[model samples]
Target chain A: MKTLSLRNLQKTYFDPYAGSQVTAVHDVSLDVEQGEFVSVVGPSGCGKTTILNMVAGFIPYSGGEILLDGAAVKGPGPDRGVVFQSFALFPWKTVLENVGFGPKMRGVPKADRDRIAREYLELAGLSHAADRYPNELSGGMQQRVGVVRALANNPAVLLMDEPFASVDAQTRMTLQEELTRIWQERKPTVIFITHDVAEAVFLANRVVVLSKGRVLDQIKVDLPRPRVWDHLMQDETFKRLSAQVLQMVRSA
Target chain B: MIASGQRTGSKTPGSGWVWRTMNSLAGAAVFVAPLLALVAIWAIVVPLFEVNPRIFPSVASVADAAADSIRDGSLIRHIGASLLRVGLGTLIGVVTAVPLGIAMGVSPAVSSFLTPLFRFFSVLAGIAWIPIATLWFGYGFGAIVFVIFNAVFFVVAYNTLLGVSTIPMTIRNAAASLGARRWALLTEVLLPGALPNIVTGVRTGLGFAWRGLIAAEMIATNVGLGYMLFVARDFYRTEVIVLGMIVIGLLWLLIDRLLLVPLERATIERWGLVRRT
Candidate 1:
């Protein structure tokens, strides 16, 4: 139940070899209303990840401000949960414990957190894997845990950074469907970052395409609810929007 | 009758564990057979050649020496003293090294400053410390323990730094994003991520500690397995010398196999942090 705003965000870092400051994310501004799903998609080096990283507070922005629920962002905190490209599940912890970690940090009692963890696991259809370690699961399953782990924390906005990129294609499709189902069920505020054009269009209510660290365009998808690859694969609007985003990305 | 017997066998308690235990016993036998054969050859060779006891005691004589030491309780006292020194030294080494290692890991400046020093000492670490250590502590428990501590400290600290620094950045980011504040991040992410390397460091460092302890004991202590061997040499009690040598070898083997290997394999492999060949 929060709105996130990024105002003229910019990132500049000195390249060691170049020996001069280079801007990674140019002045890009966007706003995501409460419980809205937004996808920021672009080619590599387009600063899509830089934007997410700055929003997640994993790195500092050189200029501009990020506000979540009207409060300015500082360093990393529990309020902004992130799903990494690498899945980043703790190898030593069981799936249940990983999901419960954020709640534990909030000092939720063991029983209460366990309940919370169980609920999230069920939401992700991972209840059976609750006791298993991350390494014991497949890459696709691991990322499923990764998504729910971020969600269970009840962050103001969830930031996902190309989370499904490492998995196989079939699994990726299934995961995309599962994610949409979970999103529709929970209606959490999300800012999902990906480079895949079709994925950006398919998953989001609004798609923001970045080109050369700047906002190239923002396309709002009017596709009907319950978006599934099965139906959307042949849907004319889905194909049109996807082609439009893909054309922009390729041109950029 | 055969079918009934099969049913009873299947119902037996811990059948899987029982099979596993049997497999381990067989594996142990396979490993020990060669060592036992070497011992048998020694037993035969010494008496058959009428080798001088001063040169090397017969297996019977060595066995008798072991029995005598056991009966008099000197062997236990010597072993107990050596173990205590090693345990205390290693304890201090690990406790002190972990924090310093973590500090260096978190800060590049600290690690860079101290890393060259570590590289130099890693080579010069063990027995070489004894002369200076004895000079400082004046030839007693302090000096010997200092040598053991030096042996363990450098390796564990260096490896711990390696461990902490090698942890994937994404993992740390995940923890931070998940609401792990500074202290929680240290205990949860950093510690667990660095565990496998830290365990390896302890194993290698303990090896160094054992060798250093013996060498230090020979020079700086009046008691210990090393001292026992040295005194036996002075009297030409080859039996006791042989006994002490065997005991040192056996103790190290026992510690490695029974404690270190299991610790590394059990927890680490279960976590899938390491793969066993």
Candidate 2:
């Protein structure tokens, strides 16, 4: 079943001062099946984030519809969770509070929400820092809190916008591995947006390449898991796929 | 790279209490030095010039007057009266202005239209309101409190509006996407994001209020620091006038350094999510 579908999505931002409309996303359409790990890759300002924003109902699209579980997305809801690039954890909130926010918003019992948040925090290897505020944590640790916050509510679909972009290279690799493990265990339909082709190829079951606010191609990653970082680099199949994706990205 | 386990965290070689006490003492010294210097200059210059003791008192005479006022308890009464007015006016202004500002700021069009109105009023807050406030509220406590209220209100409202409007759209969107409801977004995201600005506004507003308080007291009130200074001028009691001036400066310095600065620091340190340059 198609868990989520974007049909000819178009977005136009109006410049009130200039008296002109700028087309940010144009005629982009895609679908994600249940339990699919789909990654969207594009150059900077290619409107990939715009598509995610549309699906998350953060902005109004000029045209087309975003259907989640066969219903139109009207506005932001608890059914979908989004992880932002900047790790927008509430600074006033501790790790545990930030993670528990979604469930608390849904009016879940405090004990249950705390339990769920604890599970996700442990999954993200941030249980030890649960009581600490976001500012006290490192970039990687903060991103872990972001991930845990998104996953705590057990939403049907997860939308991530360059979730690991701010962290260091070492932390990024570790987080990628941890994310893969979590996805395999939880199996929520995910639509991940990133500029990095290697990151997309490593985590995604299907990779959609976007350029100039339109879909260029969608490639399938047929590799088996648990996929090790070192093994992925050494594998000839991985190399070939990476080269192909890199070529497309460069051309775009 | 050092192994995590092998890395030893550097210690500052002092207990938290010791460090805090030292910091406070240093801060106090830094604050007091200038005032002490000014006093020393005044003491020396006044005697050297042999200026009329009526116009400017010697240090010894001013010290004697200060002691007399303290002994009689009139100094405490005047200080208490000024503080009460400022305290009451500030409380009322903050309670009223914050919600109104947030409501107006939530809508961009309304906020933009009303911004000019706030700016105009904020400019006219302190000394300018004195003549009218005295006319409407009569002399003494009412007039002084009205002046202080006007001084704090408009500036706080303007700052609150700016604070809410300055929140990045990205942060709001991220919160919305993460399942924050309207109330949650307001309390968790909007409030904290605007806190630093609000604190800054309060500091600025209080500064204006303090000045306005003194000026209004001088013109329209019977019992306060400004009144004390004015009465001393009439009686040619330069010693009392000098003491009053010193007291005013010290009071303001204490309010700003002890109360306002720490409050601002805590807000920026805790809720200011963005890194400083």
Tens-digit lDDT track of model 1 for A1-252? 449989999999999999999999889999999889999999999999989889888899999999998999998888888999899999989899999999999999999999999999999889888888798799999999999999999988889999999999999999999998998998888899999988988899999999999999999998988988999999999999999999999999
The complex in candidate 1 yields a DockQ of: 0.53
Query: Candidate 2 lDDT, tens digit per residue, B1-277?
Result: 1221221122543354577689889988997898789889988999899989987889999999989999999999889998998998888887788878887878999999999999999998999999999899998888888888888899988888998898877678767776788898888887777777677778889999999998999999888898898898999998999899889988988898889888876657654453444
| lDDT tens readout by residue for model 2, A14-68 | 8788899989899999999999999999999789998988888888888998888
lDDT for model 2 comes to: 0.86
Q: Give the TM-score of candidate 1.
A: 0.96
- What C-alpha lDDT values do all the predictions have? 0.90, 0.86
Chain B vs. true chain B: TM-score per candidate? 0.93, 0.91
Can you give the TM-score per candidate against the true fold? 0.96, 0.91
Task: Give residue A67's lDDT in candidate 1 (0 to 100).
Answer: 95
Question: Which candidate has the highest TM-score of all?
Answer: 1
